[model samples]
Target: MADIATLFVAEGPAAFGVDSYQWVSLAMLVLIGVFIWKKVPGMITGGLDDKIAQIKQQLDEAKALRAEAETLREEYASKIAGAQKDAEKMMEGARREADAILAKAEADSEAMVARRQRMAEDKIAAAERDAVDNVRASAANAAAAASRSIIAEKHDAEADRALADKVISSI
Candidate 1:
């Protein structure tokens, strides 16, 4: 319901004119058509899909590695615990052996001391016996010398002849 002059101006541009808004509109439409014809949207969707798949795979691998690490940690912890128990057992054995060795050494030392003491006592007893024997011998010798002197001073040959006659008669 508009006049021809107003419609022409509102329609944006004359078809034959180079300087017009219509030309820009046509170029934008053609660019959009080209993009659609080339499947650009499909290419973008495929790329995004591939990236999602890669990320999911990486996540799964990370989960698996984490599980393996946990298992390894548990294994090493158990091994360390076992090793500690073994070490403690070894230490106990060493202590027991050391105590036994010390006790044996002490016993042996005491035995040696006792043997030496017995040997010293035996030596002292032997010395005492020898001393008593020597004293007895010296006493007997002194008594014999005194008797000889007494007989030589008090008794002459007559006393000896009398003692001989008395012994002959008694026999």
Candidate 2:
């Protein structure tokens, strides 16, 4: 116990008065905390303000882009409508032309049919007339042959001459 006391005495005031060092350490910690508290909020607020300004600028750009997109959409819609109208008009024109062509073809066909029918009728009438003339000539030839045979068998020369004259006059 005496040796322990001697060692304690040798350690001196620093060992006996540790409360003062503890107080100094506590005071330094408080001073550092106070310095951080005083300065950190201003720095954080300034950085947040810069970030907010950047966000607002980005939002404005996005709004402008949206407006441009809307304008483009409207313009394209009108163009599409105009193109549709043009296509419809073109189709209508084509249909009308086709109808006209069909009507012309029908008229030409009818005219051709009528001409063919008229030609056929005329040919038929001419053939009928030729047949009647041929039959009449054959009948006359037969009658003349019979008369010549009868005359040669029984009639005199004067009778043959008179018959010939009558045949010529009738013809």
Highest TM-score against the true fold, candidate = 1
lDDT of 1 at 86: 99
TM-scores of the candidates are 0.68, 0.56
Error of 2 at 95 (Å): 2.9
Mind sharing the TM-score for model 2? 0.56
Clashing pairs in 1: none
lDDT of 1 by residue, 1-171 (tens): 468778766554577785467788889999989988999888899999999999999999999999999999999999999999999999999999999999999999999999999999999999999999999999999999999999899999999999999999999
Residue-wise C-alpha lDDT for candidate 2, range 1-171, written one tens digit per residue: 999898756443554456656667988989979878888767888899999999999999999999999999999999999999999999999999999999999999999999999999989989998988888888889889999897678998888799999999999
Top candidate by lDDT: 1
Model 1, position 158, has a per-residue lDDT of 95
Q: How many backbone clashes does candidate 2 have?
A: 0
Determine which window of 10 residues in candidate 2 has minimal summed lDDT. Answer: 8-17
Task: Give the runs in model 1 whose Cα sits over 4 Å from its true position.
Answer: 1-25, 144-171
